[model samples]
Target: MGNKLNQGWLYTDRINAKVVGQTVLDFYSQRYGHSDRQVWQERIELGQIAVDGKTVNPSYPLQAGQTLTYWRSPWAEPDVPLTLPVLYQDEDLWAIDKPVGLPVLPGGDFVYHTVLEQLKIQFPQESLFPLHRLGTGTSGLLLLGRSALGRRELSRQFRENLCRKIYRTLIGPCSLSEQFDCHQAIGKIPYPQLGYIYAATADGKSAHSYGRILARSPEKPGWK
Candidate 1:
């Protein structure tokens, strides 16, 4: 609302960092000596700010073990007319329902046309932290973290196999009950034959997939 004040403070060696925001009126009033702590009926909502590491309330009074960050936001950045649809949020993560065809980050040939640029334009003051990748053709939930602490917590979840993932695909089929597990050696196919690492094997990355017939269309007779 007003000039965004971005400041950081650390209360203790083991604590995390935090931020404060001001609405349009209070930002200008702070230039003078402690005139009055600008209060937002809401944004002044002080809280401990770390992604995965800790939890704190805005009025925690900044103990000796905490840190703070500030951004004196001047109000002139052009508004981004478009916005990202946020699906879920908490101290540790932002989950978004991504649309198909949008790449997750900046890269060759994309530059200003990417999701990172759009988000930066939308929330001009807060730094965005993106973790993980999704192909441009894929659409689903994307997870993001706000601070180093949060990143650590999410990384632990990834390492401990605590995350749940599921995917679906539509492919034409030929059998009524086409189900079988093909277990075999996936060594390189000799010379020209084409092949790939397949099924549940003792090597390669571990992944599991399951599929069943959902709907059969009258337009496709072989699907039965």
Candidate 2:
């Protein structure tokens, strides 16, 4: 699809005690590094940011329980496939074959070019929300919930480990092993570009994955 001009966006957040004394500029620049300090200052000066329903200077000190709102001007978003193939559908659930490169949610430089936005456009009358997420580069079946009761129950199942999720990936060739398991703890580490990102670490939360060899490619020297 061609690049689309979004109808702007209104983002709001509540100031918490952790950042109660931070300046408006510092809060945004430190927490959200999408824009630089100069860009944030420009937006604040243009009345794009407000606290408690009133525009404030960049140096304005934030207080706990205050509402901060930002009006992001409409801009052209990156082009992406806007098609979603329905694999299964029911009264309370839907399973879609999500295409690769389509973001499951809005983040980074994507806003209107996400699966959630396409869902809104295709099913305007229905209130469906994604129950799980797939990476932008992964193609897989995405499950969505159409009712609050269904969503709550499925969320509970996921939290309690009642659901089994299996993923297939291509990796460099290694010694043959019938089956393998990984117990690497994953946690966020500081990243200069995007604040923090998940990686395996000793003090991170427990994570496990099971892999079974499906096939091997002689030409590519990889296992799937």
Candidate 3:
């Protein structure tokens, strides 16, 4: 199979107060770290970086409230499953069976090879937005909003904790009770590779989950 490629993309960001005085090269190199300083300089020289709609040099100083736009060239993105099955649909909502290995939105190395872009191509006449998100490695039913009013209402439902969410997973053999409640707090922590990642910590936000054993495999000593 042939790999999918996006034509091009425009990445936009606003200069915040913390990094207002930094130059374009310093800002991009220190904050993003996706490209080396030399590559960023080359892109800047090629007019790929813009400030407030005007092309700027690498030494251009950024100011608070100014818009920064990066014209990213087209590139080959990682291949992923493109099939999206509709489990349910209504005038205001849609439930899609999202396959594993497919990213819910564009980020990192993925631009056009994303569920959001695919949905836009499939429903060109409609304005649809995901109500929530699922990880790239996760396969589950994803909910979407069909209209502005629908989005607002559904977002409120999630904020008020009215919607129920359940997840099933397979794990290695272990001893466990019939039912259990895990209250592990999760928050962002600095890492060596990525800037930061979410993990369990004492000073994190409260997170709770309830799990129950449905079945046990005698041969493998696994539970579900």
- Full-model lDDT for every candidate: 0.47, 0.84, 0.83
Q: Model 1, 70: alpha-carbon shift in Å?
A: 33
What is the lDDT for 191 in model 2? 53
Comparison by TM-score, 1 against 3, better one: 3
Residue lDDT tens for model 2, 1-224? 47667888888989999999999999999888767999999999999999999999999999999999999988887777789998988888888998887888876567678899889998899888998878677899898998888788888888898987889877765785879899999886765432345678888999998889998765555433
lDDT of 3 at 203: 96
For model 1, residues 114-195, the per-residue Cα lDDT tens digits are 4676667766765556666555556778777766777788777877868755555455545645443333433312121111
The runs of at least 3 residues in candidate 3 whose Cα sits more than 4 Å from the true structure, single-residue gaps closed, are 187-204, 218-224
Candidate 3 local lDDT, 1-224, one digit each (tens): 13756788898989999998899999988877767899999988999999999999999999999998999988777777888898988889999999987777777776676789989988788788889877677899999999888899999998899987888877666698889999999886654433344679999999988999887765555442
Task: Estimate the overall C-alpha local distance difference test score of candidate 2.
Answer: 0.84
- lDDT at residue 113 of model 3 (Cα atoms): 68
User: What's the C-alpha lDDT at position 186 in model 1?
Assistant: 38
Question: Could you tell which candidate, 1 or 3, scores higher by lDDT?
Answer: 3
Cα RMSD of all models vs. native, in order, equals: 18.9, 2.8, 3.2
Model 1 regions lying over 4 Å from their true place: 1-83, 174-208, 218-224
Query: Ten-residue segment with the worst summed lDDT in candidate 2?
Result: 188-197
How high is the lDDT of residue 97 in model 1? 72
Q: Can you give the TM-score per candidate against the true fold?
A: 0.44, 0.88, 0.86
